[model samples]
Target: MDKPTGSTVSPQEALIYAMVTLSAVDRQMTDRELRKIGDVVNTLPIFGGFDTDRLVAVAEACATITREEDGLHAVLATIATSLPKKLHETAYALAVEVAAADLHVEQEELRFLELLRDVLDVDSLTAAAIERGARARYRTL
Candidate 1:
């Protein structure tokens, strides 16, 4: 939802939206993908202590974001630009986790993520670390 204030959405909310949108990209949402999203939610400190209701709200927000053609990058861009420099890695990590949720990093997803990483100004090393962690989590290790 775009508010008049134009204040950025919370990073956790943006991340949840990103994951849900990624899962819906193939026009299907599998249990595997849902579980992966849940795992990402649970593991990320930004989403710590999020309740079911909050998760659902975030999912709805994601649906709204997805409906927009700009997609996850727009949400990521908002958060990246609004938050402080110190939080960039946390945002980048969330982007990577969401991009990997479907167990297959589609080209569109990779492109969006790379755009976000660059916009967030995440360094190459941290982006690599995020990708490595995602690969490990998806059992591609």
Candidate 2:
């Protein structure tokens, strides 16, 4: 799952990596979470030009990076560098969606999301709105 030397990913791929990293942070990636990631990729206009075939590789690269010491920070740095400021909230929203996909946000996921929010520089109000929207979307009667 090692990122190849000097390899870089597109902004869309970086967003996908963020989602995949959150899904796997709890050491379990549920079917619902996986499906949610796929749905986002398939539906988001930001990802419209991305090649689906690269998903596995992007995910693996994220996993590899997260396994290193301070890897989470490294991944966040990569994400920040790849995405424009305007899309920071979008990235945080995607992470929230993936975290809520399994109908439960584990402690690890919560912490990860908090760190992501901080790293992405998403303001509290916006983060709250994004999180609230995801919760509402996944609520069960």
Error of 2 at 128 (Å): 0.7
Candidate 1 is scored at a TM of 0.72
- In model 2, which residue pairs have backbone atoms overlapping below 3 Å? none
Q: What does candidate 2's lDDT look like per residue over 1-141, in tens digits?
A: 232123346889889978998999899999999999999998989999888888888889898988999787778778877787888899999999999888999999999888878877788999999989988989999
- The TM-scores of all predictions, comma-separated, are 0.72, 0.91
Cα lDDT of model 2 overall?
Answer: 0.85
lDDT of each model, Cα atoms only?
Answer: 0.67, 0.85
- What residue runs in model 1 are displaced by over 4 Å at the alpha carbon? 1-6, 25-28, 69-73
Give the TM-score comparing model 2 with the true structure, all chains together. Answer: 0.91
User: Model 1 misses residue 46 by how many Å?
Assistant: 2.7
**Candidate 1 at 34: error in angstroms?**
2.0
